[model samples]
Target: MSDIHKHIEESQVTLSELMLPSHANFGGKIHGGYILSLMDQIAFACSSKHSKYYCVTASVDTVNFLNPIEVGELVTLKASINYVGKTSMIVGIRVEAENIHTGVKKHCNSSYFTMVAKDDNGNGMEVPGLILDSKIEIRRFLKSASRLASKKHSKFQETNFEVEKYISELKNHNVIVDYKGYK
Candidate 1:
């Protein structure tokens, strides 16, 4: 197969939806889960458009809810491929809510979703290389790379971490450790 390269803007996806009363929670605010579902949809669309294959969400690196979306606001989700590996792409999503009456906009959430391209047989498939055109694109790619590295290092620490040493460190927080249990 020939190598494929794509620009970051080539596969960008944007979705806008009006929040309805049915989508609101008991507090009359739009549900965060609803917004997350929308983000996942846009991420899938962006990655699939870029990779030309079905994509699955491997992991969600970060999801920061900056502001609460209210009912009757227009919510927009923008997604683009921030970074690409052989078979994986990091889809960065930004969500915003606008008050239709006053035309005020609020940043709702930001998230990064790691997606893996898959063939019809459910095997991993190669994805197109990202062509970063601007400084912002390059910065996003580098940020995603660093986030991925941090995640791996954190996993390694979690796997081989020493509980005995950790217990001592817990003294910095408000916690009482009763070491009576047998090892």
Candidate 2:
């Protein structure tokens, strides 16, 4: 943690654009990749603004496309720093699409992007601590922290996992095991 502290509102960013025909996929809806690109850009901007250093995306959490966007719809991405670590920040991004004619909006996606601040040498750098002034901010920070802890736990389990110990359990699943070596 750095000596400096900043509020979450200081680093909030919102980007809106009209979906173009070229951004559509074979099914005639806006492409998921294009929306993901926009989300990445907004996450970078929000994290950089809070950290005051160049940032790189470390990982993106669950991104489920809940709704499809049409070519004429207006897409909006809102990003904010939800949690800050010594050198990394978790950015919460919400994506929505609005029909221009109907003035109706639908949530397209929600994702959490982990970004790390970098120095000129491309090494990780410390970021300012977050000043949680509201219950929502506190909840967001705690949620991000919990998610990080869960991810670490999952990784640890994977590393020490014994396939042979659970091989018999595979019979309960949809998978078909045909290896002759397995008794």
Candidate 3:
């Protein structure tokens, strides 16, 4: 078996693009679907880069949209691999938005994606696990993992439905939320 990594070793992926009119909602904000679309793509990118294998989103935990973004801005998605299980990977995603005209950027959302590695046969495959090495990264990974573990799927869905629905509505309404500066 390959050694696990607690932190991303190869590299991290940052995806950024301009806010097209099609990506905006009735409120002139970026659509939630657009953000989630990018997040899923970036998550796949990070997973593919690391394992060179096919990966799929098993669950997206705590996708929090604390604010909104406007049109004519740049949406940036940054993803990093934090931890890995036998055939599962825990990814951390942070979505940011920048006003292309003014260069204002905000941290609008954060999410945890669990992916299952698969081979060409579509069966679950083994992947190198993530080994925690540093203190800070370890803390963050542990915190995320704990939240993921402790939060039951049903409860997570019910309690976080507001946030989830907001994201869904963002998709349906094509809402735009700008980023808030990361603390």
Q: What lDDT does each candidate get?
A: 0.91, 0.95, 0.79
Task: Identify the leading candidate in terms of lDDT.
Answer: 2
Local accuracy of candidate 2 as per-residue lDDT tens digits, 1-183: 689999999999999999999999999999999999999999999999999999999999999999999999999999999999999999999999999999999999999999999999999999999999999999999999999998888733866976677787778899988766646
Please, what are the lDDT tens digits per residue for candidate 3 over residues 1-183?
Answer: 566443475746899888888988888888898889889999998887766789999989888897797777788898888777777777889988888877878999999888888999998877776655678678877887787677655543664554533444456575576634322
lDDT of 1 by residue, 54-159 (tens): 9999999769988999999999999999999889999999999999999999998999999999999999998989888899999999999998888778733866
Which has the greatest TM-score?
A: 2
Q: Which of the two candidates, 2 or 3, achieves a greater TM-score against the reference?
A: 2
Distance (Å) between predicted and true CA of 68, model 2?
A: 0.3
* Residue pairs with clashing backbones, model 2: none
lDDT for 12 in candidate 3 is 68
**Ten-residue segment with the worst summed lDDT in candidate 2?**
155-164
Candidate 1 clash pair list: none
Please, what is the TM-score per model? 0.92, 0.93, 0.77
Candidate 3 regions exceeding 4 Å error are 4-7, 152-183
Error of 2 at 47 (Å): 0.4
Error (Å) of candidate 1 at residue 71 is: 0.8
Order the candidate numbers by TM-score, best to worst.
2, 1, 3
**TM-score, cand. 3 vs. native:** 0.77
**Off by more than 4 A, model 1:** 155-158, 178-183
The TM-score obtained by model 2 is 0.93
